[model samples]
Target chain A: MAQNASQLEHFGRALVDLGLINEELVVLDPDVAASTKVTYFAERFPERFIRIGISEQDMIGVAAGLAASGKTPVACGFAMFVACRSWEQISSSVARPELNVKIVGSHSGLSPNADGDSHQTYGDVAVMRVIPDMKVVVPADAPEAVEALGAIVDTPGPAYLRLARGATPVAYTEGCEFTLGRANVMRDGSDASVIANGVMVPIALEAAGSLAREGISVKVVDMHTVKPLDTDAIVKAAAETGAIVTAEEHSVIGGLGSAVAETLVEKRPTPMERVGIMDRFGESSRSYSALMAKMGLTSDAIEEAVRETMRRK
Target chain B: MLRTINKNQVLILTNIPRVPASITSVLRGISRRHKIPLSTLKRNAQILKEFNLIAYGDPPNFSGVELTELGRFISNLTVGEEPTVHGNMVQTRSGFRPLGTVIKDLRKTVLRMIAEAGSGHLGASLSAVDILAILYMIKMKHDPKNPSWKDRDRFVLSKGHAAPALYAVLSEAGYISPDRLMTLREIGSQLQGHPDMEIPGVDASTGSLGQGLSIGVGMALASKMDGSGSRTYVLLGDGELNEGQIWEAALTAAHHGLDNLTAIVDRNGYQLTGRTEEIKAMDPLADKWRSFGWEAMEADGNDPASILDALNACDLTTGKPSVIIAMTTKGKGISFMEGNKYSRKTPDAQELKRALKELT
Candidate 1:
């Protein structure tokens, strides 16, 4: 974690690089180019860029149309608006046809901290996951974000890649192999397991370290791809570690926590606690840290949830 | 699906208000078929005259009411006869037998399919027949043999309820076989209740209103980016204009200066419930489009030659999108269905037979 990096920035750069190599690659934005960091690509390849201007539903439809025309369209916009406002379009136009449109929803969760509740998205992950044939991915850090972009580019059909607005600690080193529908194990412990994704991954890793110093060994798993939840990893974490705690920057209702709980309940039935935003809207905060701390979305929250789950075990 | 608008609401009727002998014959035919009293038929004919649906014409004792130009236009659709046009055929890769003839045939096919499907949108589909026929047969740069050709012009039926018209035109164009028209709205059929791209010649799958414009804008943008001389056309219903997304896409197309995009609105003035003016007054539609930075024009939607003229008048290099506000009757050809309460419903066996006979 020498320098903080943004997953959205990494996504923009990776998409631009992919566009340069892949002639079919095209980017569509809904007036959040600079904020979503898609402006990086827009500046480099002006011809390949389409600025749709503040219409998420229209952007989704356009992207679907482009995909139908044999162009790989990456529709970029804020996570909250793109997922909620145009959920019907995504479902009907893109996913229903199984179009090769990649939806990149930036500023996911509480990342747009100072912008307040309307800007913060706690339900995007849930919304995208439920769409049929939609592949959902939330990268833990910059490197993982780039890898996820590459993976989706190679794959066909509709995929949603969630990216955060603010700078986050770099978790994976360069050349990290990203596999779709697979979890990355950052730490190994038998006492309890902390499964996390997106902005919460580094926090979960820190929580595991803090727990280790207290002689409570903890396992940290990055369940990056949310849709096809890595059942094998979760089952193993429950069977071996005996306890599980799921963390995310999204709402506790239907994001990573819900996905993990659904998997564990049907597979191994382990004691678990979710460390994410409660079922409520976010408010204006001074900073990302303040929002996370206020919402109980910190490493301390993960550690507490881990301890509570371990006690239940 | 039709509900009458306020009878007091003054609408500009396109037909002359006199009853002619031929129209009286049709009314007499209806009276004889339904066993209704001639006095009752005459009273109803007066009501129809109040709406300017028929005009008076004389040949003494044997004279019946005569259908007006508008009435004749609608009646001819039921029997499948092309309206005569002065213009010669405009050449395109897809063969054409004069657009008027093509539209009449397409309208007949649309009505028959609606009757066969047991339930389909009659008014909306018939209203948009000429617009779809002209685009498919003449205006578009499409090849039915190679429906997916990269440079082929695209048409998206944004008002998906009018899918029967698109299916009819697509089938006639050879993108689909005429035999498959019977499978419309059937399970496992490509011809769904709405337009599905799975059906050939349909550029985008659009049933939800206010969405096809955006998809068309997207395709137009793609064509511009690809430097391909392809244009994208989106056919919308006047009722479908109530959806805010249409305006959103409208603004996007204007903002992008997408000259390759054209939106043809079937301004038939009717929605599922009633007159669009009553549901939501979209009067001054051309001005609204003009204010949105589009080159807006109006034409007779049911007339293929007029529609073709308006479409040909569009200048793509002007750096603005074009929209043709086609004024049309809800059910252009069928006398009973035109502006009837059940304009959106399926035609019954008796009505279908009478309609086919009236086409001539």
Candidate 2:
């Protein structure tokens, strides 16, 4: 509602842009200055942002109290600390009450390459998905990041937003319509459905083009909303194409791949292979790309996985 | 102003927010079965007004409701004695037991529950036990029958490692099944090593220290904004005070004049490894709080009578947030563990027995 866009780029900037700011808008996080990118907002509008400082578990409860106090608190923290260290609080404090709190996690899904396993969160989405009332969002790129930020802030319930280390391509045009609970179709092909999100999204699209030239048609779907799991799109793809391959920068188990498989099997069984880090921790000695490659997340690897699953179909 | 209750419904109502169901149906049955004039029933409503079941006044609008720091203290007072929203009490005030008996029972039950579970932060639990006991049995105005009641005061155990005392109080207050107390830390029990709000009577899920106080601040601020006259109480451990976030909350409480917000620093001087002084010194503690603009009090945290009196006396501080630096003995009552530092060594049979003898 403010005239200036700079002031509008506040802690609740995304919500303000979407004209979705409400009385329930509460933003909370621990003391990581640069990671959340909330410092810009804090310096500008200090009242809206609550600095909890290095306490993920406490943030959940505090956010819950704010929620109970009739303000919506968007609780945020680092991916590994929240996804792993503070699950009990997340489960009991925010989710159990089904309080209207948004849990926005920065450094999500192996994006913390500068830091190792302690920081490179592999199972954030998976862990969040297990909690009831948790709607998980893994936005594809920077544009999707902005869009997802707007959508999730106004989503009106307990939710988790998985943000990367700003390691995303600007996928969508400056302003394209986006909402939660739906998947975006980047490419249409009948050969196989290569469902991907976060860092793997651009890679999925590139692989789709490369496979197209090689006479292997791969349909790339951006499965950003991981929890309400986009069953209709995935079911349609599985039933029609008969082959599906899922990729994410997370662990193979209980993540995007696992969520997709869970849907496909319950609706229509499709030949599938999950493309992500096979149950293993990342090492400090490897580059991000090398880690991705070693963990079988390369474009060629995804294309090959797609082709192999199609052959099974 | 204690807003007027529904005059018509007050013919038979209870608890201010609830109506006596049996009376409601009988009145309804008379109107429906006997074809009594509805306007005649309005006469009964007038009778309720005469009986003070409902205050005789013009109805107030929602706009009249507003939150203030003073409103927090207003909600905790005995009826008819309140400075605002004055309500006439229908009955004389009920009496509470002597504070000494209350403290004795609270300590016995809390330590026994933890000792039975075989795994708990004994020192932290004992340190915070008196504060928890005072809040529940004396200071806080809440309905144990309705733990999630919207208008009730909120208490956050920021140092949640001391969940044993919290669980015991919740059980004794009838918010949870007492049988569940023995099942703490069991695979499927709601009682974990730390407090989880999923369990009844817990306001927040907290195990990680220092953060619960911030949550308390948010709750207090929100309550003030919404015009909800509910106070917030947060208990932080002496060791937990080592966290920088605790200072953030402490400073904010006073800067904002969250006078309804009260905190108890459980200064038993022990952390997980040793004395907090050995781990990190946070002395000159009361002076620090006073400088932060809080009217701070130092209490014998082990004395529930002192705790009860000190907490009620908080409102007298005037226009500032209050904190009771509750000086306590770690592992109090348990002779072998009392006045000693923490050891990472898990208590074995001998230690447990010694603790049990003193606690029992």
Candidate that scores best on TM-score: 1
Count of clashing residue pairs in every prediction: 17, 10
Model 1 CA RMSD to the hidden true structure, in angstroms: 14.3
Candidate 1 ranges beyond 4 A from true positions: A1-3, B1-102, B315-317
* Chain B TM-score (each prediction, in order): 0.74, 0.71
lDDT of 2 by residue, B1-360 (tens): 334433333222322212112333444544564466666655664555454444323345212111123333332333213232112211111222333455555567666676677777776776677678657654565766677787788998888888888887777555778778889888899998888778978887778666777678778878776678678888888888888767767766665678878888888887777778888988888998999898888888886556655686776766778999888998776666675542222466666666656654
| All-Cα superposition RMSD per candidate | 14.3, 10.0
- For residues A234-261, what per-residue lDDT tens digits would candidate 2 score against the true structure? 9888876789999899999999999898
TM-score of 1: 0.84
Tell me the native contact fraction for each prediction: 0.58, 0.48
* Candidate 1 residue lDDT tens string, A1-313: 3468988877888878898899989999888898888888999888888888888998998888788778999998988899888999998888877889999988888888989999899898898899887899999999999999999989999999999887898888877978999898899999999999997888888888889999999988999999877899999999889999999999999889999999998889999999899998889887889888999999898888888997898
**Candidate 1 Cα deviation (angstroms), residue A293:** 1.4
Candidate 2: residue B345 Cα off by (Å):
11
Q: Residues B43-106, candidate 1: write the lDDT tens digits.
A: 6566555655556644464454544444433332321222444232322224424545566667
